[model samples]
Target: MGCALSGPGVTPEPTFSKEKRGLDLSEETECAETPEPLHLSEPQKALIRESWKILHKDIARVGVIVFVRLFETHPECKDVFFQFRDIDDLQQLKMSKELQAHSLRVMSFIEKSVARLDQVEKLEHLAFELGRSHFRYKAPPKYYEYIGAQFIQAVQPILKEHWTPEVEKAWESLFKYLTATMRRGFYTEEKTAGSGGKSPCSRKAGAGSTPNKI
Candidate 1:
């Protein structure tokens, strides 16, 4: 899990409702019915399990690629990310030799996390929290769509040969699960706010008045 950063004083208005945001799967009709429990053949199960390992490694690799591309293609977005300077510091942290060691640690964590198929529930919870963190950063909801597209684009070339229909299906399923979880978290925050609850770092009006980095 990423460390939580203290937010800036500027509280950007929510760009969109949870329902309108990217990856929303709140509509009951939108969720693919939990498919009949797959009774996978031994070989098929092995293939899927192996494929998941590959996916884990590939996602991390692609994350680096996407991060680089984002910095290059939309420096403005980078600026927004760094408005509070924590994002900038984290980027610097990732560039250090220590990052290679940290990557290994994170990879180990990923392996353990994925060891059980039943752990998907926990994974969903993590994703939801990550989404809330993104909101705390004042990232526009559309940024998720942009990042997702960029991730797919980055991986397509490398995955072309191994990207079977099943692989696509698996990723789609994983993303849908994540999206639904995020939507739930977003709405929960909104409800809490409406009820006069405060976030840990609620911003004062006119805080974060710094001009956007763009």
Candidate 2:
């Protein structure tokens, strides 16, 4: 459930002005206003749950394969991880216990997320908190998209027979939902940190608003 990979060190930038803040959050605000932003249906939920049951058995392998593929396809990503940064050989890196452990942790988070499919609010909260934590860890949301795609690739063969267009769509929808909320949380933290520990947007929204909850 923790940060799946290390992020580059971040030095906070200057806070936005009133007009600038509006500009900064305009897209995020638009996304937030959209109803059923995830587009996940009950049938999609069922497909995700069923596929997960099969995928979970090879969780460890899937986890390792995911990151390895990530490093292969996006070699720059490896530089973010302090532990793996120096390791040039993908084959050698594969055997490292550190990679295995962290990869497993990421998968475990996926496990919990699958279990929370029926509780939409809880699921969103979980992803949001993780995103906030990533902000602290200096993990940019840009890399989040890569992980979901890598995960899908890693699990396809494991569920070779069970893998279907429907299942793929379901998982893709889930990742989309998670990444969207996570992006919101990341921006929320960034705004708060940049503005001397208070988010200007949330202040305008008042107490107990969606921004505050995120």
Candidate 3:
């Protein structure tokens, strides 16, 4: 259940602007007008629960194996991996074995976290923090898409024999939920700052702006 590898922290300086504040307010208003309930179909919830049971039954071994396989396939993503100590660094590097190890560790942490997917609030926060981490690393948002795809690719093979159409649907549903939740967190933070209270964007904007290490 522990992370397999650890890397430096990558925290990005938040950005904000008075001019952009209006835009943020508009966005917040739109979001407020929208009704976004965590509405999952019964089948979707069942699938996620079943997958959790299967994965959690052997979380440590499965998580490590998934990480190892993913790194083996996408060796280039190593640079995005952050060490625990360097979590706040924003510098990017060429792909390397060290990066690969770090990537695996991040995956390990994610897998362990995913086992607790039933806790919607915690999972949402984890996704947001992860998004922030990715931003800190200067990784393109497409990397999140890549991670999702590669994760399914790496896991499906092992899961295929035992996997059902329901399981596939469940994973797809889960991914969508996680992605939306993360994006919502980002938007909400932006909206909050636009309304005048302190925000990461605002904090990074002023002279006293300081990044938070994850």
Candidate 4:
């Protein structure tokens, strides 16, 4: 997996309370418009897995495309990355080693998430922790949804005929589930840190914040 600069404070391993473990996929769907629980049937899972196999071959390019598109559509997000915040040139960013490494970290996280679909609890835990880490990184949950949408747009051309509505729905459901869990984690950390919420840890020269892995 790729690595990025972590936020200053130390984050503990996530714990699953009885109530938290019992939460169904839909329980975290923070969308007011659609409160439906997340439902990914066997066929949908299979569709995502199969499509991922084809996309994985171009994971690097896709990762770059996803983030580039994200920055293009949501320029404010660039502010969250210390290493990238000052760089106004989008084309130069595509070639940065930091961007490449960060992209790999994100793609690796997605790969792991896809592998864990059969294990719901594990998948939830993974995403939850990622959110907690993001809190330290100062990357809010609002930007999480954009990554998924950009990923879909980046891969649709590669998936071509295989990119059916069902496939799209499956990916969307998975992202929604992940982002919802992530949001829960973000709030949990926020509450734990209390008001002011600045990290107790010291900062490093190039330590930039990102949403990919802890």
Best by lDDT: 4
* Segments of candidate 2 deviating more than 4 angstroms: 1-36, 203-214
Tens-digit per-residue lDDT, 82-143, candidate 1: 32223445456456444344334434433543463354445544555655555565444334
- Candidate 3 regions with alpha-carbon error over 4 angstroms: 1-39, 57-76, 82-118, 184-214
lDDT by residue (tens digit), candidate 3, 89-170: 2233223345446555655556655565555555555666564454335343323444454455556656656677667655
lDDT of 2 by residue, 107-149 (tens): 9989998998776667777777787787676556667778988
lDDT of 3 at 206: 15
Q: For every candidate structure, what is the RMSD over all alpha carbons to the true structure, in angstroms?
A: 13.6, 8.5, 12.3, 12.9
lDDT (tens digit, per residue) of candidate 4 on 83-114: 87778899999988888889999999999999
In the predicted model 2, the residue pairs found to clash are: none
Q: How close is candidate 4 to the true structure, as a TM-score?
A: 0.74
Task: Output the worst ten-in-a-row residue range by lDDT, candidate 1.
Answer: 1-10
Q: Candidate 3: lDDT of 126?
A: 68
TM-scores of the candidates are: 0.50, 0.78, 0.50, 0.74
What lDDT score belongs to each candidate, Candidate 1 first? 0.43, 0.69, 0.45, 0.69
TM-score of predicted model 3? 0.50
